[model samples]
Target: MQQATPLQARVEGGGTPTMANWSLGSEAGVLKDVLLGPPEGFRWMGLENAAWSSLVRDTLRRGYSFDKQLAMRQHREMVSAYEDAGVTCHFLPLDEYNPYQVYARDSSFMTPYGAVICQMANPRRRGEYAACLRFYLERGIPIYDMVSSGNFEGGDFNIIGEKTALVGYTDHRSEEIAARQVAGWMKDEGWEIRFAPIDQFYVHIDLMVCMLNERCAAVCLETTEDDIVDWLKARQIEIIPASFKETMALGCNVVALGNDRVLSTAGAKDLNTKLRAAGFTVYDPDMTMFTWAGGGVHCMCQPLNREAA
Candidate 1:
């Protein structure tokens, strides 16, 4: 059995030591283990923070129905795709009150050192940190730190390259203060932090920008600022554009399984086709039940162990 590590692993003066067992250098590395949330208790949060998420608001406006059984089936399919890719899946303990816990990427995110717990913006979702905390502790994964400044979610913490990250905030779900707090930690560790301040309607940076591999990414030029795009280009990283319509629909949100493999949704036909043409093996699962609820596969998962890029 693995010995449990301390809840706080971050060094006060920075230069925290990296975990020997739990390693993740970049998002595009070969995914060996991933963290997921339970889908059994998932349900639509009608009128509860609906104003905070444009996708949820639009779903309510369109009078779309929520089918729990369908959601479970879709979630299983997503897991199957991950398993087929040889990625081990770890799930958080279930909490009936946190139905939105199915979107696992919001509560906390993994780093090279440990997991950084986040502060949820919505009151209804704040309890999610408990399950996240329990999971990491039980698994002996170190806890790097927690976001105490303001509201911040895991989706906004996007790692684009080695020692480089794109931290985003909307002043709504993820505030600038919290983004800086997290950025400060990364900066002190000799990382290059790029702040992307986007509109609240977009939710998180992962919604419009997700790394496809070490050298490529799927980005929504319409939603992403010019400076961010230029920065990526400056690093010789290729950009794969996703239409604004598709991006808002959560089509651009995807996961890189390394070796040119991607986990995308069936709704992302255009991007999936483009990815396939680019010699990538894509796993397109029907995730409308979750996507319509305002999160996608990327939003539903957190990488725990990724082979160094």
Candidate 2:
């Protein structure tokens, strides 16, 4: 509740953050050059990431898993979706890490300077980032720090801009450190961070908020705190409201596909309308299954390289 400090208020003229200056969750560490699709006949049972959540569940019958054949079919669909969006995907061969990590949530949170690989919030998911150790090392991504406390999920933090970030959780599912830790880390990076409250109703900041462009962002005002709103307004950010219904359907979980173009779930019509009006190019995929699992576009893709604009 203190006034914005001079350090917090300082801005480097508002630019995109470089990958070296970022922290990323490691599970989704599969590199784009080697990203893999699910195998045939393998129905994903339970996906921790909501964007792929439903597909993992609904792709099969109860008390059963998708065999190799079905898994490959599911993978084809996922690959097709990304290709349709003009995403240049690279698939790595399968390893102990499996496909959950390919989504990059387990890799590390990316800031403007370096990477922060997250510790798994789920015991079963621990050490997934370890699988990508070679990938980061070979690529020259630096590890400035790491999370050693209770479980933390990188999906929960949303970087609204170069100087600001939003963090929160949905249930204790993801520790508050995801928010608090990221905020503190960014503070050292000279960033102004804010913690927002998320519920099972909205799992992460990405579920309720997204940056569509340099000057425009989308969020469901109903779920965000007033402080976040005021902070964003002060930065000259244009607020596009996503309805509660849209938020639930993971409307705000958008991925900037680059060039002011993005990918989102098909169900967020109202939010999409606002985005189009804001001069954005929005693309939708067959996200009915993913939305049901509680994640959408943003959850599906882990961006490895985003050149600052």
- Candidate 1 Cα deviation (angstroms), residue 133: 0.8
Clash pairs detected, candidate 1: none
C-alpha lDDT (0 to 100) for residue 118 of candidate 1? 97
lDDT of 2 by residue, 229-287 (tens): 88889989888898876776677877665566766656788877777877777676555
Model 2 / residue 57 / CA error / Å = 10
| Candidate 1 per-residue C-alpha lDDT over 1-309 given as tens digits, one digit per residue, 9 for 90 to 100 | 755678889998688999878898899999999999999889988889597799999998999999999999999999999999999999999899999999999999989999999999999999999999999988878899999999999999999999999999999999999999999998988989999999998999999999999999999999999999999999999999999988999999999999999999999999999999999999999999999999999999999999977
Using TM-score as the measure, the top candidate is: 1
Candidate 1 residue runs with Cα over 4 Å from true position: 1-4
State each candidate's clash count: 0, 57
